[model samples]
Target chain A: MVVDIAPMIVLGMVILTSLAFDFTNGFHDTANAMATSIATGALKPKAAVSLSAILNLVGAFLSVEVALTVTNSVIKIQDSTGAPNPALTADGGSALLLIVLSGLIGAILWNLLTWLLGLPSSSSHALFGGLIGATIAGLGFSAVKWVGTGAKLDGVVGKVILPALLSPVIASLVAMTGTWLIYRITKTVAEKFRNDGFRWGQIGSASLISLAHGMNDAQKTMGIITLALIASGQWHDLTAVPLWVKGACAMAIAMGTYIGGWRIIRTLGKGLVEIDSPQGLAADSASAATIIVSSHLGFALSTTHVATGSIIGTGLGRKGASVRWGVALRMLVAWLITLPSAALVAALTWGIGHLVGGLAGAFVVFAILLVAAGYMLWHSRKNPVGHHNVTDEWEASPEGLAPELPKEVVR
Target chain B: MSQILLALQAAGQVLLAAVILGAGLPAMFSLGMRALAYGNGGSAEVEVEAQPHVLGKVLAYICFGVVIIAVMLGISWIVGTGMGYKLSFEHFLPVFRKK
Candidate 1:
């Protein structure tokens, strides 16, 4: 019972799945950049999302260097035989499509669940985790190009994790210095002028952070889609991305941005720290600088991690700022689990696909996904979360609606 | 000429299926948000305090669904046709098998 599908049909499926992942990526990560501004009242929620969406579209057109990293730098496209394998190329088999679609399902489910619980997890990590898990299940451990994975790890550690760990420390020091100088220089200036100026500065800085987010995060989906093509053997190499691929990924993410990830917004904006104008400005500037530099260096860092670190730094910099350790701890736990969890789901889906063959397998996987999604939607209706209650009030604990104070109080 | 025609029909089928699947999930999410924003049953005091711009949010969701499906279908049509194939939804499942 062999199934004979045309190469073009397979190619089309790959493109569609990539767009689906891209759309999910947009909605999932929107909270990373705009949550703080929206939370602090620095930017209206609608305006913040609109700005992020536009910048994300612009950023998608700027480069494909990161796309190369995902297509060739992460997974071993060639089999152990090392022959001219079409499956390893950009237009060969439908397996790549299956892998990508399953991975997306895993990541999207994780994102929706976390959002429902009002947790701020790293969407970037979730996607990566899903891909790795699915890839492992589809192909064995040998299929993982360790060298490529190592290179990505080096970039993640040096460019992403290290900076994430240190950015807050640096930001805190910089903010402390900036605040002291601001106070010293503006001793004679009216309080109104000083506060107002910083408030405007925060807006500009926040916008920059959103732009940097567009440049780094959106490119990831582009890479994954391109990788699917390359793995399928449709395209020969990491050539120019088709205009449709670029446009679809950009628009999908932008639309997701417009929809907004309101749950994470509260966790980031008001849950982590009470952000004032000056602190918000300082943090936004630092995050923007870090993300842009890394993007230029071709490292894909999690914008969520960088933004969270910056906001924490800003909180620490201020004398009386309240940093909520309990919420922060919860967010960190989600981060730790996202990659492995998504991978496990991907592995299970791949196993199921293997049990069935060709179109039947694909249909079975799709049907199961629909059922799971339906169940999730039904469960969500039991306790709905939307824009009106998408704030800290929804996360209100027994103590009160406000986030609990940090264990080590700053003031 | 026959080969080109077949390719065009195949591409159209693929494009249509892609659009429906790609846009369906987001539409569901958007509708979910709208229902939560406008649904009755909460205490009057809570409802009064929690009024969101329901019409605006629903409109945004509709526009989002339309735009995404349009873009996906449009791109598939242009790319498929430009590459010498016609885009359609029927190609979502392989109809022609090599004998």
Candidate 2:
């Protein structure tokens, strides 16, 4: 009997790539929960990220949901029971492994590129787009779940596209109402009292978002890692993720949060709007409420869209405040293309991996992902936006999304 | 069309709940701060003539209490959902049932 090691090698690559994706996901989304708080000075930049990181760790562990079928929304790789198709399991599961590997590479590369550009694109959308693209390349276009049977919300149109369009609008309305009411009710209160009180409120609401984010985002990575495990025949239980996988995923996300994606955070906190403590409190509350409510209703939406919408809503609600339409327009463009852009990259990656074939193909894709990520990291260093300058005042320049260099640095 | 309709339905529910909790909680908190200001009187409000009132302080705490309870319920809901349970308002009070 001859034993093949190709699937095992590909499986290892998938796990590593999935964790890398999770890490990017953590830092990429820290802005969604903490940007307003940081902007309002409700929490110092370091303290805000630390608190968010800790809460995310706690949140990751709290999730006990069987999310193994997470990919069902966008692709048909797995059945409702979360098991990989038997057809794809032949030859040590290399077929399924290649697809998963290429998909993860697509997600990670897109995430890094967006982070470099300081765009708050949806991490979930990128992940789904990558998977969709890779599946199309490997299993034909029919493998993608563009729409469901209409019994309930499932598939790309129902789960991803529709929610992307609707969530922001819903979040905006809720936040606008909240912001207007908050300002109205506290009109006569002393400036000192009002600022102090709303700052506390911002902290509380932002904490809720971070906790919820941990439970939501980490589970996606956990599901992917488990799927890879099952594909390689290393794990049998479809309903429960291995304990080590959970622990590793939780740590990856928490560490990523602690590192903080200062570039994207700066965009959300400073570029989009001029946020005060009251607006911050309102925006965070709206985001938290919309996310929790929608998820409970089984209508999954990206936290990025909801947070961005809430921020814009706060601007609209305030009498003198106005949104920077240029910044807003840029974000809209990013959101519109996130799916297709990630999909294109993933499809291309799948092509390259398929051409090379077997374990060597997986290594080639992984190497490309690393090189792309490194280039983005290097480029980001040119205009480093760390905790030190994350809350710097916003100034529009010819270089869009680039913050004005700190006064001390310029001097 | 059905997908759109179903999404609209879900969005409607989310919007309604978001308004009630999202806007409502912050409003309540603002009201509490206002009440606290009224209670503290001097330097707590822009009006110099305002006087401290015991009743205002009590009212402020009550508002804060309600806001805190709502947040607690939100947290509980997240935890409940994770544990394969659903938090439902059966008789105007939340109860957890198997999902």
DockQ comparisons of all candidates to the true complex: 0.01, 0.87
lDDT of 2 by residue, A1-411 (tens): 978877887888889899999999999999999999999899999999999999999999888895999999889999999999888888878888888888888888888877887889999999999999999999999999999884899899999999999999999999999999999999999988889989988999999999999999999999999988998789999879999999999999999999999989999999989998999999999999999888778899999999999999999999999999887877887798888888889999999999998888888999999898888888787778889878777774435446333344223
- Model 2 has a clash total of 0
What C-alpha lDDT does candidate 1 achieve relative to the native structure?
A: 0.57
Q: What share of the true interface contacts does candidate 1 keep?
A: 0.00
Candidate 2: stretches off by over 4 Å: A396-411, B88-99
Q: lDDT values of the candidates?
A: 0.57, 0.91
For candidate 1, write residues A274-345 as lDDT tens digits.
776556655665555445444434444566776776777667656777788877777777777776777787
Q: For model 2, report the TM-score of its A chain.
A: 0.96
Give per-model TM-scores. Answer: 0.69, 0.96
Off by over 4 Å in 1: A1-3, A6-13, A64-66, A78-91, A145-192, A381-386, A389-411, B1-99
TM-score (C-alpha) between model 2 and the true structure: 0.96
Most accurate candidate by lDDT: 2
lDDT score of residue A43 within candidate 1: 77
